[model samples]
Target: MKLLMTTAVSALVVLGSTAAMADIKLGASLSASGPAAFLGDPEAKTIEMMVDQINEAGGINGEKIDLVLYDDGGDPNKARTFATRLVEDDEVVAIIGGSTTGTTMSILSVAEDAEVPFISLAGAIQIIDPVRRWVFKTPHTDRMACEKIFSDMQQKGITKIGMISGTDGFGASMQAQCKDVAPKYAIEILADETYGPQDADMTPQLTKIRNTDGVQAILNPGFGQGPAIVTRNKAQLGIDLPLYESHGVASDGFIKLAGAAAAEGVRLPGTALLVAAILPDSDPQKPVVTAYKAAYEAKYGETVSTFGGYAHDAVDLMTNAMKTGGSDPAAIRDALEATQGYVGTTGIYSFSPEDHLGLDLSAFKMLEIRDGGWTLID
Candidate 1:
C-alpha cells in the first residue's frame, strides 16, 4: 500500500509540472522551402527573433513561450499535417502562421475542430470567411489591396489597365479582387493573362498586352521571380507602359532581377512596414517598425520584406494574447479578436466581429522604386 501511494504521489507531481509548463505553446506552419521559400524564410527568422524578445522580457504571465515551427514547403497537405501535429502531439496552446492563403485554409478545419487559435500570414479575404471562431490574420486582404490600389490609380488618372497574374493562391486572390472591383473604379481591364508559378518566360503574355488598346497601365500581381520576368520581358519587348505591381512584387530581389532599367517607373502598394522610413513620427507603428528594422538588419544584415513584417506581426500579436490570457485557447482567441489599436511591424491592427482584415486603405501607401530605392508617391 505504501509503495502504491508513493507512485501515485510521483505521478501527481509529473502532471502538475506538465500543467505548469503549459503556459503558452505556440505553433507555426510556414513555407520554408519550394518556390515560396523567400516569403517564409524571413517569417521563420522573425518568429525566432520575436520568441527571443518575448522570453527575455519576462515572458507572458511569468511563463516562457515555446514556439514550435514546421516548414510546409508551400504544400497544403504538409500544412494540414504540421498543424495537426502541433495541436495533437505537441499540445500547443495556440497556433500561428500558414504563410500563404491555401496553406492556411488547408488547416482551418483542423484548427476549428481542435479549438486552437489560428493566426494566418496569408491575406485572402476568404481566409477569415465563415469566420472560424479561432482564426485571425495579420496582412491586409487582397480585396483591401485592390481597393487601395484602384483608389490611388484614380487619383493618378489611370483608367485603362492590363493585368498579368500567376495561377497561385496569392495571384488568384488579387486577380479576383481586381476583377470584382474594376467596374466601381471605372477602370477598363484590357488584357488579363495568367501564368503558371514555375513558368520561365512571360514574353508571350507581354506581347498580348502590347497589342491591346487603351492599356495605359499594367498590373502584375505575382511573386517567386514572376515580377522580374514581367519587367524584363516588358523592357525586352519595348513596352514602356506604366507598370503597377502588387505588394508581393515589392522586393529588392525583384528590382535586382528585373535590372535597374526594367524596374524603373514601377509602382505598387506597400504596407507601412516596407516603407517605415518615410512614415511620420506620430504613426503608432513607428517604434515597433523601427525596432524590427534595426533588429532584422542586425541579425540578417539584409532588408526586411512584407513577408517579414506580416510574420513579425503574426507572432507578436499571438504572443501578446497568450501572455494576457494564459494557455486558454478560447480566451486567447477572444483577446485576439478583441484586438484594437495594437501596433506592430505591419500596421495598427483593430479587429472586430464584422471586420477581420485588420487595416484599411490607410495601412497601405503608393510606392515607386526609383534609383534603387523606395520613393513614397504623394
Candidate 2:
C-alpha cells in the first residue's frame, strides 16, 4: 500500500509540472461583430491563424500558445470587462489586441495594473504618445497618417482644404491631429464638418465643404461606412476636388463599400500590404507582405487588409519577445522594448524606451485608387 501511494503521488507531481510548462496564455479583446467589425474581424482572424501556425510548428520555446479571445463588439465597456477577465481570471502573460482606439484605451488601465505586456492593434497617436510602461502598438498613429497626407497635399500644391470627419474616437482624433499639423505642411483648413458614425448621408456636410471658399481639396478622416458614405456623397454632389482619406479606411472593404467608381481618384496613406503585388522586388517588405498576404488569403479565401497586417505584426512582436523573455510578463516587456531591425509586413520595427510604435512616415505609401485597385504614388 505504501509503494502504491508513493507512485500515485509521483504521477500527480509530474502531471502538475507538465501542465505548468505546457502552454503560455495569451489574451485578445477585439470588436469582431460591431461597427468596427471590419477592423476587428481581420485582427482576430490573423491572431488565431498565427497562433495555430506557431503551435503547429512548435510554439515559442516548445510551449503551445493558449489564446483566450473575446469579441468586445466595439464597446469600450465590454472591452474593459474582457481585459479584466484576461488579466485576473485567465492570467495571460501578454495581450495582443485592441482593434480600436476606444477599446485600446478601455483595456489600458487593466493591463497596466496587472503588469501584463499589452500590444494594441489600434491606430491612435494617444495610444503611445505619453508612453505607458506596459503598452505597445502595431499600427501607425493617426498623427502619422495626417502628416503623410499633408505632405502629399503640399507636394500637389493643395494649400487650402476642407475637412469632413466623423465624431467617433478615430475620426475625431485624426481630425484634431490633422488640424494641428496642417500649418506645418503649408496647408490651410478652410472648412471643417463633422458627422455621426451612423449617419446615412453626409451630403449636407460635403455640400458645406464644397462651397467653402479657397478649398482646393477635401480630406475625410473617418472609418467604417462613414467615409464610404462621404465618398459616395462627393460623387453625387459633383465635387471634383481631390479627395483624400485617412489611413483608418485603408482596406479593400472601403473600396467596395464606397463603390469602385466612387473611390477612384481617392488617395490615402497606407501600408505596403495594399500594393504588395506591384512593390519592387528590392523593397524589403515585399517578401514579408507577399508571404503574409498569400498565407492569409489561402487560409481565409478573402482579400487581406492593413488591419490584419497590424495583428500579424503584433503577434510576431509578442512571440519573438517570448523567445527571449520567456513567460514572465516583465521580461517580455523588456524584450519588446529592446526589439530592433525586425522586418514586418507593415515596416521595419525598432522599439525603444521612448517610442513604442517603432515606425515613421517612411512606413506609409501614398496610394491612389485607380481602375478599382491601389496605385502607389510618389
TM-score leader = 2
| TM-scores of the candidates in the order shown | 0.91, 0.91
- Model 1 spans > 4 angstroms off: 1-22
Error in Å for residue 99 of model 1: 1.4
lDDT of each: 0.84, 0.92
For residues 159-181, could you state the per-residue lDDT of candidate 1 as single tens digits?
Answer: 99989998887888789888998
RMSD of 2: 6.2
Clashes per candidate, residues 3 or more apart or on different chains: 0, 0
Off by over 4 Å in 2: 1-22
**Worst window of 10 by summed lDDT in candidate 2:** 13-22
**Considering only N, C-alpha and C atoms within 3 Å, which residue pairs clash in candidate 1?**
none
